[model samples]
Target: MTGERSVPKPLVLQDEDARGSRLKNTDLSDSFLRNLKMRDVEIRDVDLSSSEVEGANMSDVRFHNVRMENARFDNVNLTNVSITNANLAGMTIDGVLVTDLLARIDPDDDI
Candidate 1:
């Protein structure tokens, strides 16, 4: 068997410590993560589409150049969060359109 490649097995880490590790070009799709202490972690160029996150404490997090189209967030705190230069088209807050709210705030300004 020449030029044959072997399939890699799934890597499992239970009760293991992997702090201060850098992961690049890793495929973690369909992976299950529970009870993880990922505070002060910096993640960049990651694909987390169609992922379900529950019971997460993500306060004081910074997001830049992130694409979150058609993403739904429920019961998430946005205190003191600032968003600028974002595409808010077709976005809503509490079943009310954001563009409508902005229109109410400043009727003369075009949205």
Candidate 2:
């Protein structure tokens, strides 16, 4: 798909103080999110392609079936982040605390 794909509108990200917020089927494609602090946010079946997420503090976030291609995570602190069954091609992650981010998929492998 060219450009940003269609996704669910206006997902409420839980703050750092608010942990374990249940979320599902959200679309965050081609969006710009900066300086967001959240905890235990579950994002399932979301299209997060071509989005710009910089300087965000996302701890204990779970993403299932999310497409994060061409997304930017520059200077973002992502501790305890779990991403499953997601396409993370061309995504840039720079300057962050990614102690809990485990990439199950390899970007070098052909799909």
Candidate 3:
């Protein structure tokens, strides 16, 4: 088999406080972001394919024009988040029960 692997892109964090910061227009392809606490963070026009986000707590997060293909979100707590025009294909949220956290996203999604 050919060695064709997709590497995850790096996450550009705003600052130490991560207040009013946003990770927009980033290219995080196939990267795994785990155990990170994100608050009031906005992700727009980013590609997060095959990324594993586990044990992370997020609040007031906004996703606009983001690409989330084959992303894994397990054991993650997303309370009061928002996502718009995001491509969420093959995303799995097993073993995690979400509430208002994912309400910002869509409920009638096929992913």
Candidate 4:
């Protein structure tokens, strides 16, 4: 038998403040972490795939080489966000396709 186990769900937190906390190498996959003030927290090497985040405020967050495929985002604000070296294929903003917009500037796209 394989030693594979399912990820456990997270505890529901309501009106809790966890700011100025340092978390390193934490595994929070398949967890339900929703609605609990988490501002200015330093998170490194954490897995947050398949996580549901709604009605939250996030500012000054930096991500590197994170996997976010098949993720749905609704009513979220991203001010001054920077995304680099990531796939933007089939992504649309205001009915404008990202791939289509890049195609216009790079016709041949040999660079």
CA deviation > 4 Å runs, candidate 2 = 1-37, 59-111
Clashes of each: 0, 2, 5, 0
**TM-score for each model:** 0.87, 0.33, 0.34, 0.58
> Which residues of candidate 4, in runs, are more than 4 Å off?
1-35, 94-96, 106-111
For candidate 2, give the lDDT of residue 40: 45
- Best candidate, lDDT: 1
Residues 8-49 of candidate 2: C-alpha lDDT, one tens digit per residue: 566554444444545455444555555554444445445544
What do the candidate models score in CA lDDT, each in turn?
A: 0.90, 0.49, 0.50, 0.68
Ranking of all predicted structures according to lDDT, beginning with the best and ending with the worst: 1, 4, 3, 2
Residue pairs with colliding backbones in model 1 are none
How much lDDT does candidate 3 score?
0.50
Q: Assess candidate 1 and give its TM-score to the true structure.
A: 0.87
Instruction: Return the clash pairs for model 2, or none.
Output: 7-27, 8-27
Candidate 3 lDDT tens digits, 1-111: 479897665655443565564455555555555545555444444444544454454444445444444455545556645555554443335643344346567668865
Model 3 clashing residue pairs (backbone): 8-30, 8-31, 78-101, 79-101, 80-101
Worst 10 residues of 1 by lDDT: 102-111
Best by TM-score: 1
After TM-score superposition, the amount by which residue 98's alpha carbon in candidate 3 deviates from its true location, in angstroms, is: 16
In candidate 1 the C-alpha lDDT for residue 68 amounts to: 98
